[model samples]
Target: LAKTTQPISMDSYEGQEVNITCSHNNIATNDYITWYQQFPSQGPRFIIQGYKTKVTNEVASLFIPADRKSSTLSLPRVSLSDTAVYYCLVGVLSGGAQKLVFGQGTRLTINP
Candidate 1:
């Protein structure tokens, strides 16, 4: 299994673009980077996924460098409601991508 490391916490304000980076130096070539956002007492919601380069969706964008040793999750113009814990997961699609192992995540706090 691949392990990920990210900042313990972050702070932002309304209408701010927040970027969270995660390091996975041991990630395998077949592994993919997945970002999830979880609100209090709720299940994590998938934000985006990427193997290399960039991937964008309605909520966020995932950027993976060519080396694939790290990835950055970009949240564009976030609001106070965007406050939540973000997780960077590394897993292989064939190995059940949805079955991500639990780990410490980055807590994002949005203020007015």
Candidate 2:
């Protein structure tokens, strides 16, 4: 199990790509880093998840270091709607239950 560390706040202009980084120095061997986005008063929405190297999807891309100690979430051409709290977490199975351990989310403010 590992705890993540990320910035508390970030600012970006509309139509610009935004990248947020998370650090997990003591990550386990079989851990997956998952990223989420949550708007105010709304539940978190799954963004992306990865194990090693790079994983890209339609919405975002996840880049992980070889040592699995850190990851970066990249959003291309972000807009105002992308303003939200971004979370980095590690999903693990505990006693037949899946548990998501997350760090303090980073609040991203997208301006026009």
Candidate 3:
């Protein structure tokens, strides 16, 4: 399994952009890195996924280095409501009796 590490917390002001980087020094060949965003009481929503290079969506952008050891999540014009926990995960999706495990994520506080 590929283990990831990220900041425990970050502070950002409203209407500004925020970027959180995660490191996975031992990423495996079968593992694909994915990012998730979670609000107060809701389950995390998928932000982006990339095996290599960059991938962007309407909510955020993900940039992965060539070695696939690290990735970054970028949020544009973040608002107070965007204050939440961001998680970077590296694993393979499984069927049958498999379940996904989450890590201690980066808490982003958007101050107004």
Number of the predicted model whose lDDT against the real structure is largest = 2
Model 2 clash pairs? none
**Model 1: residues >4 Å from true position, as ranges?**
92-103
Model 2: per-residue Cα lDDT over 27-85, one tens digit each: 66787999999999999999998999999999999999899888999999999999999
| C-alpha TM-scores of all predictions | 0.87, 0.89, 0.84
Per-model CA lDDT versus the true structure? 0.84, 0.89, 0.81
Going through the candidates in the order shown, the clash numbers are 0, 0, 0
In the range 20-100, model 3's lDDT, one tens digit per residue, is 999877666666788888988899998888888888889888888898778888999999888899998875334533234
lDDT of 1 by residue, 1-112 (tens): 5556899999999999999999877676676788888999999998898999999988998899999988999999999999999999885233544344433689999999
Q: Candidate 2, residue 58: CA error in Å?
A: 0.6
Q: What is the lDDT of residue 2 in candidate 1?
A: 54
Give the CA lDDT, 0 to 100, for residue 11 in model 2.
100
Point out where model 3 deviates above 4 Å: 92-101
